[model samples]
Target: MTSHRKSLARVLAVGLAILSTGLLVAAQPGWAAPAIPAAQPVAVSAELTTADADAWLDGVLPALLEREEIPGAAVSIVRDGRVLTRRGFGLADTGISGNQPRPVDPERTIFRVGSVSKTVVATAVMQLVQRGQVDLDRPVTDYVNIELPTRFRTPITLRHLLTHTAGFEEVYANMILPAGTPVPALRETVTAAPPDQIYEPGTTPAYSNYSYALAAYVVESVTGREAAEYLQDEVLRAAGMATASFAQPLPERLNADLAQVYPSRHQQPIPFELVGPWPPGSLSASAADMAAFLLAQLNTGGSALLNQQTLALMHSPALGEDRLGGLAAGHRMALGLFEEDRNGRRILGHSGDLIHSHAALQLYPDDATGIFIAVNGSGARADSATVLRRAVLDGFADRYFPAAGPGPSPVGTAADHAQAVAGIYGLSRTPQSTFMRAYSMLASVQISADDAGTLTIPLLTDAGGTPVRLAEVEPWVWQDSEGHHRVAVRVDEAGAVGAIGVSPALVLLPKPAWQVMAAPVVAGSLGVLLFALLAWPVRAIIGWRLKAPLDLPRRDMRLRRITLTAAAVIAVGVTLWAGAVMQMSGGFSAQPGLIRGAQAATALGALGLVPAVWRAMRASRQAHKSRAVLATLVALAFLGFGAVALAGGLLLPDITY
Candidate 1:
C-alpha cells in the first residue's frame, strides 16, 4: 500500500510481507539504485537554453530507460512559457518479430497521465471559482447531488478536496475496470456509494481519488455538462492542450495514438485500463500537449488559462502548512499539487500511476520552469517507473539549481525528540472499514532510533536507494542526515506521536503496539494450529494400531475431536484467504464467494474455544499432563486467531473490500 500500485498489487505485496516478514525486514533489493556513475555538479548557467536542455536530456534519459528496462517514455521541458525541448525515447509498441516497432512520438503518441490529471481537474475547479460559479469554502453538498456522510459536523469544502484534506479513506474498488466496461456518469459514480468521511475536513491530508471525483462531480453539477466535456472545452482548450482528454476509453481519434503499457519490457501489454473516476486519473495526453499546459500555467506570452489571483491560490499551500507545528516545514499540500521543494526551488507538482504507466509534472514557480515526463512501462521492478521519475526530477534540480549550503543542524533536544517519535507507523490512507484493513496492519513500518538518537526508516530511501538516516533538527521535525528529505511527527496532548508526515502526499498514523503485533501473532497461531492438527492424526493412527483407546471418557474423546477439527479448519481457512489475495486479478468484490467461504470457515473455527478449553481442563483434572499441555496450546492458538479475525473486520456483516 505504500507504493504506487496500491490496489490489487499492493494486497499481494502485503501478503508477501506477512508470509515472509524476515525478507521484508532485511532489505528491499528491488529498489536498489542502478549502477550508474554519479554526475559531478555543474556550474549554474546564465540562462535556460533549448540546446543545453536537449543535451542534458539526451545524456540522461536514454541511460535511465535502458537501465530500468522501461520500454518508452516522453518528456518535455518548459521555461519562461516556451517549450525548450520535447523528445521521446524507445519503442511505444514493441512489435512482434514479423513487424517493425513503432517509436514513441512526443507530438502524437498519447499516454495516461494518471494522478497528474488531478492538477488538471484542480485547474478546472479554480476556473469556476474565478468565474463565481463555485464556492471554495462552501460544503460540496451545495453543488453535488449526493449527501456526503461525515461523523464530524465540519463540512467538506472544495478547498478540502483540492488539497486532499477532505479525509475520504482510500477507495480502490471500481477505480480500474476491464477495458470494455461501460463508462458510468460522474454523478452515478460519486453518488453510488460515497466513502465515509474518516477525518474532519481540513484537518488531515489523505490522498484520495474519490475526493477528486467528487470535486469533478461538483464541476458537472455547476456547469450542467459532463465532466469530460466541461474540462475539454474550458480547461484543456484554454491551455491549448488540444490532444489532452478526460474521457474514458478515449475518443477513437486519440485511441489510435495511445501508447501500449506493459508490466515490463519482457511481458505482454496489460488490458486497456478503464478508469472509473475519469476526472482523477483518466486523462490521455501527449507530451507536447502537456508542455502547452505548462506554458499556460506559467502564463507565458499572456496565454494564461487562469487569472493571476486564482493561479496563485491553486499553487499555494492549502493544508498542513502551519497546523502541524514544526513539521509544517517538511511537506505541504498545495491546492491540486504537492509542494515538493528541492535544491532551494519551490517545486509544485503531482505524480500519477496506473499499474503499468507512471508520470510526474513538476513546476518551478520561482524560475518559471516546468518539466513533464511520462513512462509507458513499469519495467523489471514494479517500481522502476517510480525510481526513474525520481531520478530525473531530483537530478534535474541538483544540476540546474543546487542548494546554497548544508542542511540544518540537529536541535539541542534531538535525542529526546527522536526517542519520543520512534515506533511502528501505519499509512493514513488505509481502509479502516473493510477486510483490506488486515493488509494495512501487515504493511506497518517501524521507525527505530539508535543510541545516538538518529531515526531509521527502512521504507524511505535516498536517490541512491540507501536507507535515509534522519536526525531531529527541531522539536518534532527531522531532516535527512545525508539527503534533503525531511520528516515531521505530530503528537497528541499525551505527547505520543499521532501521525507522521513523510511527504506532501503521504501521512503515516501511529499504530498501537498491540495492533502492530497482530500480523505476527496471527502467523504464529497458524503455525501452532498446523502442528497440533498434523499431530492429532498421527496420535490417532498410533492408538488405533495398538488397539489401546479405552483410557479416556466419551465426552473427553468427543471434545478432543472437535478441538482438532477447529485447528484443521483454521489452517485451511488461512491458506485460502492468503491464496485469494495473491491470486486476485480483480477487485475483492469480484471474488466474493472465495472471501466469504474463508470468512465462514474462520468464524466456525472461532467457536471451537468452548470445546477446546473444556478438553484442556478435563485432561488437567485427569492428571494427563501431556494431553493437557497440547490441548492448552491449541486453545491459545485458536484464541489468538479469533481475536485477529474480529479486529480485522474479517467477520464484518458486509463483505466490502
Candidate 2:
C-alpha cells in the first residue's frame, strides 16, 4: 500500500510539473525568426535632377500645414547628392508664457526627429555588420548575458530585432516609469517577464518597442559602448549629421537652436524625460543636417558608417508581402527603413513620432528625390505621416518642386457648380439598419469646383459642443492640419442641412442625441438577457435536479421532462426572436451592416441552447435513459448565425471602406 501511494504521488508531481511548463510556454509572445539572406550589392551615386523637386517642396509646405493644422514644421527635399529645398513655417510654440515663439528654420534649428532615429540606429547596426562585429542571424542571447524566460520558441536575433518581429510585447507606454524609480538597465528590460503569446513566432507581426530596446542592448554588448556613443561614432559622423545626437538629455551644442516641442491640443510644452527608449526616438537634428544625411546615403557605397550592400539589406523588407499602410505593394523592411514600390518607383523611407514631434524621411532611389519633414508639435496623428508623404509625392508629380506653374483655376462657372454640388448627403437606411448613427449630427459639403476652392467648415468634436474650423482641401474636400478630412456641406432647395456624407474610412462619427440615449440602454438590456439565459442551466442544476432527482426517481423523472420541454420551448422562442431581429436588420446579405446584425442574432441564438441542453441531460440522467441532443444542437446553430449577424452590424462602419 505504501508503494502504491508513492507511485501515485510521483505521477501527480509529474503531471503538475507538465501543467506548469505548458502554462509557461503559452505565455510567451511570438517572434519571426526568418533566415537573413546574403547581402546584395547596390549601386550608390549622388547624381539626380533636383530643380523641379525643390519647387514642389516649396509649394507643398504651406499646403501641408494648412491641411494638417501643424503650428510649425521644417521640410527638406533632396535628390541624388544635392539639397533641393529646405524650408520652415509657422510658430514652434503657440503658448503665450512659454519659450519665444519661433518659425521653423531648417538650416539652423534642431527638432526631435522621433522614430526616424530608428533609421540612424539601423545604419549603426549595419556598420557593425559590415565590420563583421555582429552576425545578423545570430541569437541576441549569444551577445547579451540576460536570463530570458524559457517560453520563447526560437532565440531572438539581430534581424528580428531590426524588423520588429522579435516577439516582444508593445511595452513603450508601460516602459515609462515614474521619475524616481530605479530605471532598469537595457538588459533587465529585454529579459523582463515575457508577455502572453498572441501567435507563434513568424506567424504574427506586431510593432514593438521592446525589439528596438533589445537591439540597443545588443549594440552595447557587442561594441562595449553605449548605444548613443556607438551611433554617434559610427553613423551620424559618417553621414555628416553633425547636429544630430542620440543623447536623451539634449546636447548643449544643439540646445540653443532646439525647437520647443509642444503638445498639440493643450498647447503645453512636452517634457523631454518622458521620451522612453531613446534608441528608437531620441535623436534630434535640423532639416539641413538630415538633408545632408540623405545626400550621403545617396552618394557613396563605401561610407564609413555602412557599406552599400548592408544598406540595401537594411532597406529590404524582412517580412513577406505585408505592406505598411496602403503606401506600396509587396512592401518590406530593412534595418530601420522600409522599402516599397510606389507607382512603379522603388522608394525608401522611415517615419517617426515621439511625444511632441512628428517626422518623416523618404527617398526615391530612381528619381533621386528625398523628402523630409520635422514638426515640433505632436498635433499630427500617427497616421498623418502617410498622408504627408503621399501629399509630398503628389506635389512632386506635378513638377511643383521648383514651383511649376499652378494649374488653371476653376474659379468662375465651374467653381459655382462645385460649390453648389458641395452639400451634406447621407446614405439612406439599409434593410440591415446599417445607416450611420451620426449622419444627422455631422455635416459635409459639396463644392462648386472639382479640385480648387477654399472653404472653411466646422467639425464636431468628441464633446457635444461647438464645431471647430476645418480647412477645405479641394472644392468639396476638407482636412485639418492634423490630417482630419471632411467633405463640403450642401444645402437642399429648402436651405436646411439634411445629411452628412463622410469618408467611408471614417468610423467614428458624432452620435445623435437619440442614439446616444438609446444605444447603451439597448445594449445593456440585451446583455443582461443573454447572461440570464446562459446561467439558467447552472442555476437549475444546483437548485432542484441534484437534490430531488436521485431521491424520488419517478417524481424527479416527471419534473425533469417538464423542465426539459419548457427549456426547449423557451430556447425556440428566443431563437425565433433573434431571427426576427436579424430579419428586421436585414437578411444575411454580404453588406457589412447586415453581416453585423446577423452576428448579433447568431450570438443570441447560440446562448439560448444552454438551458435546453442542461434540462435534457438532467431528464436523461434521472430516468437512466437516452434522449436526442438534436434540439440543443439546433439552438446552438441559430445562436451562431445570430452572433455573426450582430458582429457584422457593429463592425460594418469600420469595414465599409
Candidate 3:
C-alpha cells in the first residue's frame, strides 16, 4: 500500500486544502535532514560498536519522536555483510494511561513490513525463475487462472507485474478486508473485478498493489503451497529471518511480540490489520531478523534461496525510462527494487506504508551496507514516516557515502514553457473507469508557472516545515530551492504535458479544467438544483395560503409537480448515500443498495426534466410572462446541472471508494 497509499492520500490532502485556503494547493512537508550517522565505521575488535550509531540516535531520535509525536520504532543496521546495530527506541505500547508506556524490542518485537512484502514476493518469484518452473517473460495467465483483459493484445508478463508496468488500475475499494473477516483465496482476491487495463502492457509505469497480489497468486500456483506457507518455509527460513512471518493475524504466538501501531501518539492503537489480498503486504518481522535477511541478500551466491545470477537480475534495472515511478530523483524501477544512482553510486531499495505502520529497506548492493527501520507511526502527519525512514538512510549515506559537492544546481526552463506545464495534475493510480475517478480530484496537485518562468507548486516543505520553491532546471525538469528534490514533466509530441513527474508523488498529469474545478462547479450546481426543487412545494403552499386562483393549465401544473417530486428524490437519495460513503471510507461492500437506487432515481429525475422543460416553454407562451420566464430558467438550470453531474460521474452506481 505504500505506493497505492500515495494516490488515496492525495484525496485526503484536498479536504485539508479546502479548509486551509481557497484556490490554493497546500505544500506537503518534506523530510528534515537526519542527524549525522556514525562517522566512518572503524572495526575495533570486530564486535559492533555503538559509538557512531549512538551519537545519531542520542542526538536525533528522541527529539524526532517528540516533535512528530511518534510512539516508537525498531531499526537495524547492516554493514559489510554483518549486523552492525539492532535497537528499538520509545514505547512499543502504552497500556492505558497516556503517561505509561511499554518499550519496543529490537530483537524480538515484530513490525508489519507492509509493502516490503513485495521484495520477498519478488524473491520468491526469482526462486521459481531459478528453478525454471516460472518464466519471467511469459504471460501471467500461464501461472494464474486470470486474464489481464487489456485493451492491447500485449499479454502482461511476470516481468511487467514485478516492475509495476502491467497497467493495472488501482482499486482501493474493499482492498483491506476486516481482520476478523475471512480472507478470500489469493486467486479470488486478485481476479475479482480485475483492474481496467488503461495502458498497454509494458508501457507507462503505474504503481499497483493488484499486480503484486497477482505475483503472489503465481507463487502459489508454482509452489503448490499457499503463498504464506511458501514464504515462511522457503523464503523466510532460507534467508535466516527466523522471527518473520507472512501469516495474517501473525499467528497468536507471535502477536504478543508485535509492536502496537498507533495512529498518532494521542490515539489508541488500531487492532491488527488483515490484508485481504494478502500479497502486496502482510509480513511481520523483527529488526534483528531483518538484519539476517539483509545479510543474506548482500551475500548473493552465499544465499540459500537464490544464486548470484538471479540476485543480480533482481537488483538490476529491469524497468527503465527517463525516470521511475514513486522513486526519488534519478532513479528507475528494477523488478521489485528502486535502483537509484546517488552520488555516482547505485543502490536498490523500497519503502512500505501500511495504515498505522511504515517501513523502508534499502541497500547498496555493491557496498554491501544498508539500513532498515520501521516506525509504529507518526499519527496522521503527512511526511513523518518518510521523515523517520529517510533520516536513517540519508544520514547513513552522508556519513558513509559522502558526496563530492551539494549535487548540481537546477537548470532553467524556456520562457514559453511557463504556461505549458500549468494545470491540476491527478495521481496516476486512480480508477480509469469507475465513479472512483472523482476521488482523483481530491488527490490533484495544482501547478502554475509565473511569467519569470518559475514553477509554483506547493510541492513539499523542508524539515523545518516551510514550503520549498521550485524552478525549472531543464526544460520540464524542476528543482527545489534546496536542490534536494526534482520533478520532471513528460510532454507529448504535440507539446501537451502528458505527465508532471518521474516519481509517483509528482508524476500526475494535467486534468481537465472542468474536472479540476469540480469542487466549486459541482457544489454550485447541486445548490441551485436543491433550491429550485424545494421552491416547488413552497410556492404552491404560498399561493394556496394567499387564496390566489391558479389560472395555469392543469397539465402544466401536473408536469411541474411530477418533475419536482423526481428532483426531491434525486437530491435526498444522493445526499444520504454521499454522507454515508464519506463517513465510511474504509470499506464499501460490493453491492451498494441505496447507492444504486440513488443512481436510478437521479436518472429518472434527469428524464423528468424533459416534460418540465416543455411545460415551462408553454407557460412562457401564456400571459404570465414574468413567472413563465423564471420557470423556464429554473427548468433549464436543473437540466444543465443533471447533465454536468452525469458527465462527471457524480451519480455512478458503483460508489465504492
Candidate achieving the largest TM-score: 1
* lDDT of each residue in 329-430, candidate 3, tens digit only: 233466687653344345677777776788878877877776788888755476777776667676666556654444334445545676887777776666
Model 1, 1-657: lDDT tens digits are 113324457655676456332000101223211111113432354346888778888898899989999889999999986789899998788874333688999999899888899988899898899899998889888987777878888888998898778878776676677678887888888877777778777767677888888999888889989888888998898788878987777788888788888887767887666777667888889999999988877765675578766776777666543444444556667778777766545678888877687888989876788999998898987568878999888877877777655666777887877888788878777777877677677677788998767888766788777788988776777777434667777777787777787776667778887888898888887777788887877877888999865478899989878988987777667766776675453332346777788888889988888898898888888777987898888888888888888888778877654
Off by over 4 Å in 2: 1-51, 150-153, 175-184, 193-198, 319-329, 380-390, 397-657
Count backbone overlaps in model 2.
69
| Reference-based TM-score of each model | 0.91, 0.53, 0.83
Judging by lDDT, tell me the better candidate of 2 and 3.
3
Question: In candidate 2, residue 490 scores what lDDT?
Answer: 30
- For model 2, how does the per-residue alpha-carbon lDDT over 1-657 read when each residue is reduced to its tens digit? 001001112222322221111000111133122121112322232222455445555567677665665667887877545776787777666555555666777788788876677777777777788789898878878988875433456666787777655544323122233334444555655565433333234323334555677778878889998777878877787778878877766767777777876655345665553345556666888898898778766543334555566655555555442212211112335566655223224556776655446677877654556778877764555334335544555445323222122222223433453454444322221112232222121222222234444443332221122343344433323433322223323334554333233321111122334433332333343343344446557756876865742333465446444434443443453344344333322111123444355334434344544554554455546443433243333334334333433432432434221
Q: Which ten residues in a row have the lowest lDDT in candidate 2?
A: 19-28
Of the pair 1 and 2, which is ahead by lDDT? 1
What lDDT would each prediction earn against the true structure?
Answer: 0.76, 0.49, 0.68
Error of 2 at 279 (Å): 1.0
